[model samples]
Target chain A: MPALPLDEAGKYVAGAYVVFVVLLAVYVAIMAAKLQRIERELRELARFAEQRNGERERERVTTDV
Target chain B: MYGKGLRTLSIATVAALAAALSLIFFYAPLDADQGFIQKIFYLHVPLSIVALLGFVAGGVYAILHLRSGERRWDAYSYVCIHLSVIFAVGVLITGSIWAKASWGHWWVWDEPTLVSFLIVFLLYATYYPFRYAIEDPERQARYASVFAVTAGAFVPLNFLAVRLAESLVHPRVFATTAGGLPGSMMLAFLVSIAAMALLWVTLVKLELTAKSASGQLKRLRRALDAPAPGAPSRVAPEV
Candidate 1:
């Protein structure tokens, strides 16, 4: 097979690399979304724990009084 | 635990990929036959090779899962296959592009290698629906391991059949005998393969860490006697 002219061959080569880069970027974006969900959940869990601690402290104080 | 050393691994992957790309463009000589179009070979072939190996690795992990009855092995198998499927997609698209550039068509049934790869891709594509169909988590994981092992065995056989199918049109680029690839091309190809392999590992680790974190969250919620927030994942088995 004869060598393809540089300009023509360049387009296809560039397209292939671009596809690869775009796929990686998309995967990174997905990981970011997952990280966000984890962060939100952790925050909620922390708040829940704090509220539970406060309830326990208030009940102890009332019992002592 | 999965996240440990992730930063270093990612940095190494980037460095290797940079080296591979530079070597591909600057170091490797233009092919006498295919010229600049041949540059696609470095990317396409390495990805195909790594993805195929990944499928087999998934199968191996599946075997371990089955032997030990451990869910972590199942998680490992699932992630390996999942990433490989993505890699396979890249392979097929890039392969098609290379084929079109070389053969003047988007697809051709005549090439056994291309057709066989397509068949393999199609078979793996059924995995998601198959897992989703079985609602029982234990049963689903077991069945999936069986599928992974069966499919893993199929990979090598498929490649052998394609290789033997008598097609002189597709150049065997890896023919490493007398009058085969020159040293520079071989070096660049090896570097590209290393880069792709590293990239695969880094992404797999990233995904496993995310899944692990999710699992930890569920454990914490159970300890706190809190309600589960989201609908359970149908396809991905939790560790």
Candidate 2:
């Protein structure tokens, strides 16, 4: 849909540049979401480990008392 | 702490991305030749360069791991290669769009730019299998590192070969903005690069975390599956 003589080449180039920005922005957003999800999962795992550790500590105190 | 690398990389990347966008949008001169489509050049070219750099990082880390016998180096190597792969995909997609407008094709084998990208893609595709083939962690890391190191050298060589084997139908990269582009445009371009690099590091860190978590999970499972300290004598007798 672009005409010749390189007059509109500038327009085409501009279009390409715009597309790049949009793509990059989208990519960053997706990565951010993925990172957030992974962090959430890690938090859950850490909590599980902490709970197990707490239970063991309680058992030790009961025996000592 | 994400450490200096992550922190600097993250901040720099975000900032660069912001700057790059602004430059391209507002400051950079409209191409004298390619016109509007030329704008894609700012994004497309930088991506290829970044992807190439990513592979180089992987390959270098791989060599270091092999020489030193450090398992951690292998982790870094794998991460670098992974980042390179992601960037490579970006290059291909953006390049294809650029090609369609310029050369009127979604795909072309002979274009040096396209050819370089494809070879890089193929090179990286094999990396994952190399990663997963061996069951032993140390062994897997050792062999994979060697492959990564070797692959890094070959990517450049392959790129050079493409140039030699066929004429570059596409425009020479970075030529447009190389000659005294306006200040704002320069800033935007730099910002984009920084943003991209940061984001790449973030992904690498994420992958590294996943790798470590999986390893720990395995250890936990092993501990659970192990037999109890005492014998089965907890039961009175075999009925």
Candidate 3:
């Protein structure tokens, strides 16, 4: 095969590299979404635990009274 | 534990990738045949090789899963195959681009190497549905491991078959008598492979760490008697 002119071949080379970069970006985006979900769940769980603790404290105060 | 040394690995991957890109563009001499287009060879070949090794690694993990009946092994196997499938996408897209630039066509079915790779990719593509089809978690994992192992074994055999076939289009780099690549090209190629392999390992670790965190949260939910915020994933094996 004859070598493509540098100007023409540059586009194909750039396209291939772009494809790679885009794939990596997509993967990173997916991982970010997962991290966000995990954070939201952690916050919810923390609030639930805090609310439970508050209720237990109120019950102990009433019993002491 | 999965996240341990992740930062170091990520740093190494970035450095290697930077060096590889520099070497490929600035240092490596242009090919006599393909010229600038041959640069794609560095990316396409490394991604393909690393992805193939990943599939084999997935099979090894599956073997461990079967022998030990351990869920962690299954999780490792799942991540391995998962990343490999993603990498395979890169391989196909880049391969097609290379083909179009070199052969004046986006695809050629006549090439054994290209067709065999597609076949392997198509077979692994079925893994997601095949895994989800089984409802029971234990059964799903066990069956998925079997699929991974079978497909993994097929990868090498397929490569061997392609290697033995008469090559009409695709350049057989390794089969060349004058040594596959010039020294500068070989150096760039080797660095690219290292970068890709490191990236693979780092991503695998990142994923496993995330899964571990999710698993821990599930354990906490159970202990606290709290409702789960959403439906559990049907396909992902837990850490």
* Candidates 1 onward: DockQ, in order: 0.78, 0.24, 0.89
Across A1-65, the per-residue lDDT of candidate 2 in tens digits comes to 35334555555565655565566577668656745754665565566677778999999999999
lDDT, candidate 1, B93-185, per-residue tens: 888888889888878898898889998889889988988799888999999999999999999999999888878677687774676779999
Docking class of 3: high
lDDT of all predictions: 0.91, 0.68, 0.93
Model 3 chain A lowest lDDT segment of ten: A1-10
Worst window of 10 by summed lDDT in candidate 1 chain A: A18-27
- Model 2, residue A27: displacement in angstroms? 6.5
- Which regions in candidate 3 have their CA more than 4 angstroms from the true location? none
Could you give the DockQ of candidate 1?
0.78
Kindly report which residue pairs in candidate 1 clash with one another: none
Q: Tens digits of per-residue lDDT for model 3 on B54-157? A: 99999999999988999999999999999999999999999999999999999998889999999999998999999989888899989999988999999999
lDDT of 1 at B212: 94
State the displacement of the C-alpha of residue B193, model 2, in Å, after optimal TM-score superposition.
3.9
Model 1 stretches with alpha carbons more than 4 Å out: none
Query: Judged by TM-score relative to the true structure, which candidate is superior, 2 or 3?
Result: 3
* Model 2: CA > 4 A from native: A1-65, B1-8, B174-195, B209-239
Cα deviation of A14, candidate 3, in Å: 0.4
lDDT of 3 at B32: 87
